[model samples]
Target: MSAPMPTGVHYHQRSRELALTYDINGESQSFRLGAEMLRVYSPSAEVRGHSPEQAVLQTGMKYVGLKNITPVGNYALKLHFDDGHDSGLYTYAYLWEMIENRELWWDDYLHELKKANASREPLGIPLQRQ
Candidate 1:
């Protein structure tokens, strides 16, 4: 059976990160998600669905960066990527999973990018305005 959903909610915001905590039917839960991590793992159809082959391989995203984060209700969020993508609505359940399995996800991302000879860091990177 799946673990119960979260109840009480708390978000710990840092200068460049956000950590969340909650209780699900009395089960305590938590996740610490970095802005870069969130940007890389967005679950929009652009990143996830429309067929596995149709999935765009995100490269040079290490420099893409986060422009801003918008709330999409209590359970989701809308992220504006520095590359100009702002369509994904990431749910808490998904973010929680990403946080819980961060190592695996990160490994997979790197592996895929490497298989395509892609670089995580961009070339000719442009500076962002502070």
Candidate 2:
């Protein structure tokens, strides 16, 4: 109903997923956003670009994981992805936007991948961490 107030955020390394809990309209809601979704939908200039026409489609990022997360002065988070992608600044507003648009964006991504004859799998297998 309104902007969600983030109560907690956690990145699970083993599953490469982010758990977000927020309070909206006095109701607490939780969501688990996957690493592949985050990486592919990064808001960095490299991914989103200066203009819509200049955007780049990310591919072969199925194995990317959340390595670290740093709070950015209360306004945003600096996400360090396992695949050396750490430039995107994910703001609370943007994260909410991601939640809202997840389905449409994912479908578009899948369609793009199919049209490009590309795969979500990585070129090489990822090594398991002990």
Candidate 3:
């Protein structure tokens, strides 16, 4: 089954989040999705690969930012990240899945990072962008 279509999809540059709003049962629900989450969990073949075993683990994406978002027909949106990743076509259902399972997925991602001795920080430093 398809997820409820979003009424609004707006990116907040200052906060680095994609604000998705939907109307369900006459109630308004909004989700603030971080750019880093989108990048690390990208649906592109480069990231997800063709099989589960071939999936690539993304690290150092804590500070990733969205460069652009383009609507793909009416079913999906193409997200372009600042790191030159723009292949993922985020479908409405998939985006909803992210919203519903963020905590679980995040915990799993952190576990994977830890197992690999990976850090979200690049060069172990937090670089401020002006």
Q: What is the lDDT of residue 34 in candidate 2?
A: 86
Give lDDT tens digits, candidate 1, residues 1-130.
Answer: 3433444333333344555666756667766666656767778787766888778777776645556777776778777776788888877778678767998988898999889988877678466645
lDDT of each: 0.69, 0.87, 0.91
Q: What is the per-residue lDDT of model 2 for residues 1-130, given as tens digits with 9 covering 90 to 100?
A: 5557579998887788898898777888888888999998999999989999888888898878887899998778889988899999999888888888888988999998999898888877767765
Best by TM-score: 3
Model 1 C-alpha RMSD vs. true structure (Å) is 3.3
**How many backbone clashes does every candidate have?**
1, 0, 0
The TM-scores of all predictions, comma-separated, are 0.74, 0.91, 0.93
In terms of TM-score, which candidate is stronger, 1 or 2? 2
lDDT of 3 by residue, 41-77 (tens): 9999999999999999899988888889999998999
lDDT agreement of model 2 with the native:
0.87
Residue 16, candidate 3: Cα error in Å is 1.1
Segments of candidate 1 deviating more than 4 angstroms: 1-15, 24-30
